[model samples]
Structure formats: C-alpha cells, structure tokens
Target chain A: MIRRIAFNLFAWTIVLAVAFPLFWMVLTSLKPQFELFRRPPTFLPETWTVEHYWTLLSSTKFLTYFKNSVILSTTTTLVVVAIATIGAYSLVRFRYRGRESLAFLVLFTYLLPSVVLIIPLYLMLVQLGLSNSILSLVIAYTTFALPYALWLLRSFMAGIPEDLESAALVDGASRLGAFRDVILPQLLPGIISTALFTFILSWNEYLYALVLVNSDSARPLTTGVMNMLVSSFNIEWSLLMAASVMMSVPLIIVFAFLQSYLTRGFGAGGVKG
Target chain B: MAEVVFKDIVKSFGSFTAVHGLNLTIAEGEFVSLLGPSGCGKTTTLRMLAGLDFPTSGSISIGNRVVNDVAPGERDIAMVFQSYALYPHMTVYDNIAYPLKKRGVRKADRAPMVQKTADLLQLTELLRRKPRQLSGGQQQRVALGRALVRDPKVFLLDEPLSNLDAKLRGYMRVELVELHRRLGRTMVYVTHDQLEAMTMSDRIAVMEGGKLQQFAPPNEVYREPANRFVAGFIGTPAMNLIDGTLANEAGAWRFASPGITLTCPPLTDDAVSGPACLGVRPEDVLLGEGPIRGQVQVVEQTGHENIVVVKIADGIRLTGRAGADHVWRPGETIQCAVDVSKAHVFAAGPSGQRLNRPLTKDQPRLAKEGA
Candidate 1:
C-alpha cells in the first residue's frame, strides 16, 4: 500500500510538472495584471478578474483571429482528411505500377522541412495573386498537413481486413458501395484521429502563417495573438496568457469529444492483430 | 440451383503459376469441396469461381451462361470467407440484410427474408448483437446466415469453420451438410482439412502444387486414391507407402520388398511391371496372423484402436491398426497379414499414378471376397 501510494505520488508529480505551464496560463489569465508579477508570485490569483478577457473580446482583434483560426483549421482539416482518406485507401488497396513509390514519395515529402518549402510556396502563391489571403494560408497548410495525414491514415487503412471488402463485393455491393458501407464505418475512428491531428496541427501552426499572410484581415490566431499581445516596447503577460487559454479551448473541446477515438486509433495503428 | 463449369482454367501471377489447366464441372445442387494443404491453389480455384479473380485462359460458366466477364455481384453467388468478415460496425440483422439492400430489395420485404434465415440458423435472438459479442460458432452461423439469406445460385465457403474449436467444428460440419440439403444450392467449399472434406462433401477435389490431383467421391478418394500424393494426403495415420518392386511371375503378380512379400491384385492392361510403391491403409494391415513378420516399434492407443508401427526391415516401417483389446509393446516380434485386395500399387515416383485395375460394377464384391 505504501509503495502504491509512493508510485501514485511520483506519477502525479510528473503529470503536474508537464501540466504546470498550462495551469499557469489559465491562472495568470484570471489574475488582475497587478497580481501577475507579485513579489513571490501568487500560486492562486489574489484578485480574480475578467477584465482582460472582456478587453480581449471587446477591444482587440482576438475574436477576428479566433474566427479566422476556426475557418482556416476546419477547412484545412476537412480538405486534408478528405483527400488523405481517399489517397491512403488507394495507396494501401489498389494494385498499380509505381504505387509503392508514390506512397514512399508522400512520406519523402514529409521529410522535407517546412522552411524549405515556404519559399517555393510563397513564390507560387504570389504568382497566383493569392498572397496575404486566407486562401494562400490554406494552400500553405495543405503542403505539410496532407502528407502527414496521408501517412498516418495509410497505416490505419492497411489495418482493416481486405476480406471485409471482398465479402462486401461478393454480397452484391459495387466497389464504391463497399467502400461507403464497409470501409468508411470501419475507418471512422481513424478518420477522427487524423482529423484531430490535422486540426491541431493547423491550429497551432506558426511558421507557415508567419510567412504566408501579413494583413490583419487574414491573420490566424498564431500571428494575430502574438502581434496583439507582444509589441516592440513591452510584452503583455496576462493578456498573452488569456489569449493562450482561449486558443486552447477549441483543442480541449475537440480532445474531449474524440478522446476515445483518438486512443483507439493510436492503439489500433500500432499492432495489426 | 445452377451447374458450374471451369474449362481449361489457368491463373498465373506474373511468372508464378498459381493454377494451371484446370477443368471441373459441378452438377446442379452438388456440394463439392476443393481440398488441399496451403499453397496448393484450392483457394485460388474458389476465388476464380467467385469472380474475385480472372483466369489467365479459360471459360467459366454458371447455369449454361459464360460468366468469365461478370462481376461477383452480378454472378448471383455468395461467399463465406474464412475470417467470417462480418462488418464490425453492424448488428447481425444489418450484416445479413446488407446483400439484400444492395440487390435493391424493398426494405419492408427484407425483414421477413432476414427473419426466416435467422430462424433457420437459430439466430433470432442475436439479431441485435454485434458479431464480436457472439462466440465463434455463433459468428459462423451468422456468416452462413448472410450467405443463405440471398438464395443465390451458388454458395462458396472458404475454410469457414477453421477458426472454431474442435467440438464446434464437428458440430458445424453436420450443420453445414444439413444446410446444404435444405437449400439445395450448388456449393463449392475450400479447405485444407481432409477430415472436413471427407465428412461433408458429396465429392472432393484434392489439389496439390496448383493442380487437381483427384476429384471423386470421398469413399473413392479414401479407398482408391488416384496417385501417391492422394494416398499419402487423404487419411489419418496416412496410407503406408512402401517402396518395392512389382513383377509378373508366370501367371501371378507379386510385390517384393525388404523382409516383406505379398500377392498383388490384378492390374489394368497398361500396367508396367517395374519399381512400384505399395499403398495400404493402416486398417487393412490385419495384426496377429499371416506370412509376414516384423518387430513392433511403437504403439499409439486411441481408446477404440491402437496404431502399431512395425519395423519390417532396416529403414522400412509400416503403420498398422490393431484392436484396443490387445496391448502390444515396442520391440515385440509380431506376425501380420496384408489385405491385397484393398491395397494400391503406384508406379514409382512422387506423382506416380495408381496401377490398380478399375473396379467394375460386379467386381466390388469380388474384390471384397478376395480380401
């Protein structure tokens, strides 16, 4: 019993240590700006206030950035998951020349650093007259997200038994009908996990957003929040924490709703049997 | 019910031939099993019949219609996969109803058909449960139910009961035979288990190395195997094959081997007298009396009988079955007799053909009388 207690205490300590920054962000966001930098630094807020949150909502472009992030992330996730699901299915199931090399090429693209592709992407977007727009950022996000999502989903698709589709075909379903009825339902947990990863990746992405879009109208949460809270003269600690907490709320919601599917997806992808 | 035929079927993947020059015809409502060990092209043959695969060169026909170009769905057939392949997300009702839905059956009419199948398979209560919730036997029944619900022209089962426990496998064997009798649908089953083929099929097609070895009734396959491979493949405590020489001495045919000699049955007109392999089932080698003598090497008891392995000479052993009433010990010298009428003599080699004269209509009793 004592050993069990010690182990539990040790485990919680590591968990809290990992979670401390997040805890501090929520705690500092609630604190009045005066309480943020106290002598010893208060563990709990001495004066809890929502004025920073009110200011973030009412005065700043925080809501605009929030809206932009939602649209950009959702669009990127839907588009990436859609294309990756079909692409991954073809890579895993179909017999064709160069299929294996095509799949390897997808993974090979993922190996290339985002910074290396950003220059070419910027050139391409400018040539298309799409620079400094949300459309350009969406295109930019697809470059990294598509490959990652496709590679992740390929293994998940391979995990599904080919016999299921054969049984469906013999049972009178057409090729697409078999995919819709049998493959899709079985692939739901995988799709959820891939969509979650793509969503979070797009949401937290910084490098592409920094390089692609410059105007306030198309700025996502990453750059918008950084520009709003951090300035040339001073850094607004409480307001930055407030923006961080707000930025994480959507992710937390997504994680909460799909927590079971995410764990199942990861577990299923690891071992075939 | 429909007749199925495969004419000169050949399936090759690149340069590796999985099946070669295969031809078979199944009469309407026949239960034919394609039986062989793994990598023997049994499943490949079944897949070609199911339209999941195309033959390199051949014509496949069902009910007199050439169906080589038809899709699996359009072929009016259903298949039970070895894995059962139940859609993991659907309940039993939906799994069985899916094919009907694809066939564009009215939704209202589907329930009664599914219900009747469920009733036939005794799965009424499991309609709401998912496949994972059921036992292996129940899942097998659901797979059969799915195939049966369609009333297709043919049913193809690929090692459907292999995943079940031994007792469940035995039980499903009888259930499947009865199911076939009731449905009267042409069924093609593929399995490696010789016992399953022997117990369940009307005729067994034994395959090896991508070629059909013998396609005959189970009794004929057991008693009169076509070649050395079939003789060794089809029995428990497989037929004892002794490398020997057969010669025509004046009028009588004689088989001679180290420390053993026996009179041989009459051969067909084309029989060649030379190096031959003698095949005798363990039961046909009667223990405790005759002209041959050997030392018992081992005795395996199985309640009803004992499989006695006797060393007749150096590097030569013959397995013979004895009644369980007698307890025979290793190293004991014993006398035995060969039932030559029931024995098979094949021309020497792996693919050596049976050289026994074909049994005529009145010759079966004559052969037994000679035994």
Candidate 2:
C-alpha cells in the first residue's frame, strides 16, 4: 500500500513539472505591468489588472493575427486530417509492391525538419505568387501537419481488423462502400485527436510564417506576438503574456473533445502516420 | 441457393504454396466443413469460394457461373468471421440493414427486412444499441442477422463460434445447425476442432499439410479411415496404433504382437506378408478379458468416463476408457481383450495405406494416391 501511494505521488509530481510553464504563463499574464520583473519572483501577483489585455487589443495587430491563425490553422488541420485518414486506410488495407518503402518514406519525410526546406519553399511560394498570402501559410501548415497525421492515423487503423471491412464487402457492398460504412466511423476518435494536434502545431508555428510571410496580412498569433515583443527594444512582457494566453484557447477546446481518442482506443500515441 | 465448385484451385503467396491443385464441389443447400489444423489453407479455400481471393491456376464457379476473376462485392455471398466483425459504430438495426441499404433497398423496405432478421435471431429489443454494447453472443447473432438479411447465394463461415465459452459454443453450434436448416443456403464452414467438424457438417473434408486427405460423412470417416493419418486423427483419446505383423494360423489370419497373438480375420487377396501398424480404438478395449494383459499405471475418472493408462509387454503405453464408477488402482494387474473384428492394418510403406475393405468399396479409398 505504501509503495502504491509513493508511485502515485511521483506520477502527479511529474505531471505538475510538465504543466508548470503553462501555469506560469497564465499567472504572469495577470500581474500588473509595473511589477512584471519584481525581485526574487513572488509566487502571487501583488496587484492584478486588465492593462495587458487592453494594451494588446488596442495597439497591436493582435486581432488580425488571431483571426488569420484561426482561419489558416483550422483549414489546414481539416484538410490534413481528412487526407491522412484515407491515406492511412489505404496503407493498412491494400498491399502493394513498394508498401514497405512507401511506409518508410512516410516516417522519413515526417522526420525531415521543415526548417531545412524553408528557403526552397519560400522561393516556390514567391514563384507561385503566393508569398505573404494566407494561401502559402495554409499550404505550409498542411505540409507540416500531414506526415504526423498520416503516421498516427496509420497506427490507429492497424488496431481495427481487416475482417470488419471484409465482412461488409462479402455482404453485397463494394469495397469503397464498405470503407465508408464500416471503417470510417470507428476512426472518429483518432481522427479528432489528429485534427487537434495539427491545429495546435499550426497555431503555434512562428519561424516558417515569419520567413515566408513578410507582411501583417498573413501573420499568425505566434509571429504577431513576437513582433510586439521586439517592437522598440524593451520586452512588453504583460502584453506578450496576454497574447500567449489567448493563443492556447482554441487548442484547449479541441483537446477536451479529443482526450479519449489520444489516450485510449488504439492507445497508439502521436509518433506514426 | 447455389452450388460452389473449385476446379484445380491453387493459391500461392510469393514463393510459398498455401493450397495446391485442389478441387471440390459443394452441392446446392449442402453444408460442408473445410477441416484442418491452422495454416493448412482451409480458410483460404473458403475465401476463394466467396470470391475474396483469386486462384492462381484454376477456376471457381458458383451456381454454374464461373467466377475466376470476380470481385468479392460482385459475388452473392455472406461470410461470418470468427471475431463476429460487427460495426461497433452503428446500432444493431443499422448494422443489419447496412447491406440492404447499399443494394438500394428503400428506407421502407430495409426496416422490415432488418426487423424480420432480428426477429428470427431473437434480437428484437436490442435494435437501438450499438455493437460495443452487446455481449459476445448478441454480437454473433447480429452478425448472423446481417448475413441472413442479404439472402445470398452462399454463407461462408470462418470459425464463427470459436471465441465463445464452451457452453455458449455448444449452444451456438446447435443454433447454427438449425439456422442452416431453416435458411438452406449452401454454407461452407471452416474449423480446426474435430468434434465440431464431426457434429456440424454434412461432410467433413479433412486437410493436412495442404492436402485433402479424406472427405466423407462423419461416421464413415470414423469407422473406416482411409489411411493411418485419418484413422489416428478421427477418434477421441485417439486410436491406439501398435506395431505388429500378420500371420495365417489354422486358416484364420492372426496379428502377432509382443507377448500376445490375437485372431482372426482375412485380408484382401492382394495383401502382402510384411510389417504393419494395427489400429484399435481406446473404447474397444474390454477391460479384464482374454488375450492381452497389462499393468494399469494410472486412472482418471471425469464423472462420466474413466481413462486408464497401462503399460503393455512391448514397452508401449496405451490409454483405454472405462466407466465412471469403476475403480482402477495404480500398478494393478489388468487383463483386457481388444476386439479383433475392428482391427485395421496399415501398409509398412510410408503411405500407410489400408490392406482390407470391410464395407462398400468407396468407404476408404487411400490406395489410389498419385495414381
């Protein structure tokens, strides 16, 4: 009994350790702007104010950035999730000659850091006349999110047996018809979590959007917040903290709905496509 | 209803052969089991009949229509899987109605069809529940309802009841047999369990090492096995195989084994004088009798039957069955007589062909392999 209690306490400590940064972000956002850098870092704020939120909302292009982030990330996430689910289904159900090679490429391409390809991608977008446009970011975000979506979805699809789909086929339904009727419905949970992950990853992306989009028109919340922090030298800690808090809301809503799928069902975590 | 035929069917995976040059015909409305150990290609044969697989070297016909390159969806067949493969996302009603809906059955028509099937399978009250909410038996009934609603040309069952507990398995076996009788569609079932093949099939096709050894009615396969393989595989506690030789004494044939000689029977005129393996069923041992003597090493009583293990003179351990109430002390001197009329002689060659015929000519036809 004592051993079990100690193990649970250790687990909770690990959880708190990981969650410390997000809690600190929220706490620091509530502190008054004047006392933001106080001495030994007081645990609780001496004074609380909405001055940071007002500063971010009234002066910066934070609202426009927030809107662009919502639109571009949501669209890319939806497209990546839908395409990845179908791609994973094909990889699981159909056996082709280069099956292993194609699967290896999926993981390999996922591991290829997007930072290495930014120069070429930026030039390609400029040639396509898509630079500094939401279309380019939408396209870039999909590239970043799709491999992980495909890999994780492929792992989830493995848990669902081929027998379920074949049973539908032999019951006078076409192969595609069986996939729609029998397979797609069971993958709802995994797909939701995949969507959530893509949305969050795209939401928080800054380097590519900064390098690819030069204007405020296509800038997302992360790039926008960094610009506000870098404006005129000294760090605007309170306003930056407010923007950070605002950026994580959409993901929290998505994660709440997708918790079960990410944690159970297939029990396959986010490493595969 | 349709009769399915496999003409010279062969299936290979890359360089490995799963089934080789197989030919079979299932009569209209007949229930035949493809019986074998695992990986012996029984399920593959059933899948080919369902048009889910392509034969490498031969043709398959269902109801006189050759379906060599047909897709599974185009074939009018239904298969029940061992996992009960119900769509966990759909309600029981939608699951049963899914096939009907796909074939463009109107909303009004699909309901009654699903209803009729549910009523037949006794799944009336559980229509609104999803498959994940049902127990294992209920999920099986739902799978059957989905197949039954189609009214397909044939039913392909791949070890459907294997996942259930023994009692449920027994109950489902009877229920499935009755279901087959009522529907009367040609059903091709697969199972590795010998007793299942014995109790549930009109004809059992025994397969070993990717070859069809024997295909016959249950009692015929039991009473007159075609070879040493079939003889030893068909019975409970298995047939006791003892090495012996044939001798003719006083114009009656006798089998001479170590410390015993038992008589008498006559073989066919083509019989050769040589070593043979004699087969006797464990239940045929009449304990405490004439020609054979042994010491009982151990006894097991399972409330309905007793299995007695004894050591004979040839240093062979033979198992015999007795009644439940009887007592058998360890190391007890027990005398037993094995029935001579039920004796079987297998060829000394590796083929293990039988040397006699006690019944109609077609009962055991193993002497004709590779002819």
Chain A, candidate 1, TM-score of 0.94
User: What DockQ does each listed candidate score?
Assistant: 0.46, 0.38
Off by over 4 Å in 2: A1-32, A35-55, A123-130, A260-273, B244-275, B324-326, B348-351, B358-371
List, in the given order, the native-contact fraction of each candidate.
0.57, 0.49
The numbered model that scores best in TM-score is: 1
> Which candidate gets the maximum lDDT versus the true structure?
1
Pairs in clash, predicted candidate 2: A150-A273, A151-A272, A151-A273, A152-A272, A152-A273
lDDT of 1 at B7: 96
lDDT of 1 at B342: 80
Across residues A174-261, which tens digit of lDDT does each residue of candidate 1 receive?
Answer: 9999999988878888899899999999999999899889899999999999988899999999889889998999999999999877
Residue B40, candidate 2: alpha-carbon lDDT: 85
User: What are the clashing pairs of model 1?
Assistant: none
Give the best candidate by DockQ: 1
Q: Write the per-residue lDDT of candidate 2 for residues A227-269, one digit (tens) a residue.
A: 8686776877788888888888878877787786665543221
